[model samples]
Target: MMSALEADFGQTPSQTVGPYFAYGLTASQYGYDFDQPFDAVLALENARGERIRVEGRVIDGDGNVIGDALVEISQPDGEGRYPQTVDEARSSGFRGFGRCGTGTESGNRFVFHTVKPGAETSGEAPHINVIVTMRGLLLHTFTRIYFSDEAGANANDAVLQSVPADRRGTLIAERVAQDGAVRYRFDIRMQGDGETVFFDV
Candidate 1:
């Protein structure tokens, strides 16, 4: 027989991220209502930047939309400087972050009103760091949204360079013009063919 200390300590199986995340992680559900939609704006009053819209759908392996997915994004200000604190962010009018849920009726679409992020650090292209969470996800998925317009900068970005050439396009957002507004579409595919290029971090 194995000694008490020598006996194996079985590990617990991992659990999925949600079904409850919508009620728990959201601002309105958390009792902090801003009286506006979740994707309203990242920068406030005095924030300096060219306002733009980023919208996309979250699709699953089978090409079905995942309506309940929650998306969170972080990006630097137009000048490429990130706000260091809450107070600084509010005072400077630069939120530098935003979150939104993919409503079921809207075909799992999510949108964000924000400025185009600039290159803060050298060798890093202007990109938004994205995190996605949903009911069946064991952990949040991470990826970067690169601008299709920045071909030159993107060509030199270390992270972009690391991705295989054929798959690199999965990370770039397509620029579009609609209703006199500029928008970028960046769909996230959870699995199967054409899966978005996710990072290890």
Candidate 2:
């Protein structure tokens, strides 16, 4: 009797988003806008916490800028409380979420202006969850952006500890300041050396 595993079977071809993805996803390009706001301005006025800037670039395996990648980030307010409802988010001036598309002309650079997030809980370190989507990706990738300034908290963070010691630096963002305003720089590498540490979730 022949084993079932001995039979030859064809493999399915992988699918890709291909070109022209922006027509449906990007509002500024084709006006198909989602109901929620994409910019990270949690509030226009009376918003709590210190305002900060986050910026970065998206690069591919070959070291070329992706140029059209879309990044979404979810973070709590400075107090670490997420709004329970859309109405509450709007009223409390806590957007707690944002999406940004890398610039095609500007070499895949993205920027977000929002308040510095606090720890979600007493024990957890302050971090922002990120999701990336782009052409050629069969599934989206997930990662976390950690603050370099939180050395003590990061050392004790459960999630950070779970990652391999050598790869943990990929998740930490570099801190910079301009004109007295704080900024964090985090670059995403899709593959190859120095590739970002993506999470299973």
Candidate 3:
């Protein structure tokens, strides 16, 4: 579904939405052939001591696969509250969200890379959340995992409910899965498709 914002500016690149927002303005639903997605590549692994890993992959509107896309995943710190820090990161402009590095320890646990997510609406069963265990600077643990996301399923997600407002964009991710090596090139904020916006209730 093309967002109401994308419909406003017929055919031109934009950096500003209605008035104040100036990021992800030129966002378009998968117009034309979604077969050709922008370059994107990323992955995620659990920090839990189980064989759990969320193999995220990127997919086009037509269900095609996008490769070579770069993705950066971040969440709130322990207590699921990293509002101050994230604002600091985002304050540095694109540099904050653009810096590609390994995952960090937050929210009383660890979070790392996972594959991009498929175009599954929020109403499907628990997909794979590859759960892994990281100890020290070495491969201290490993395992697979299964997590859940339900646009039509649950009104509230545990991990998702831990974030604060305004800074809730931290929960967004274009993570998905596909056949071969895929990538994620979707821009997400605190609303609509592509952007995995969650609540703090």
RMSD of 1: 7.5
TM-score of each: 0.84, 0.84, 0.24
lDDT of 2 at 76: 87
Better of 1 and 3 by lDDT: 1
Is candidate 1 or 3 superior in TM-score?
Answer: 1
Candidate 1 CA-lDDT value? 0.82
Candidate 3 per-residue lDDT, tens place, 18-123, comes to 1111112112211333332211112113211222122243332344332322233332221222225534434422111111211211212222333323323333
Model 2 stretches with alpha carbons more than 4 Å out: 1-23, 29-37
Task: Please write out the lDDT profile of model 2 over residues 1-201, one tens digit for every residue.
Answer: 768898656433222342244333555533455543455455445556678888898888998887767777888888888878988887877788877777543656777777778899877999999988876786889999999999999999999999999999999999998999999999999899899999999
Residue-wise lDDT of candidate 1 within 95-129, one digit each (tens)?
88888877642565888888889998998899999
- Extract clashing residue pairs from model 2: none
In each prediction, how many residue pairs overlap at the backbone (N, C-alpha, C within less than 3 A)?
A: 0, 0, 43
Model 3 residue 186 CA deviation in Å: 13
* Candidate 1 residue spans exceeding 4 A from truth: 1-16, 27-40
State the TM-score for model 1.
0.84
- Quote the positional error of residue 170 for candidate 3 in Å: 18
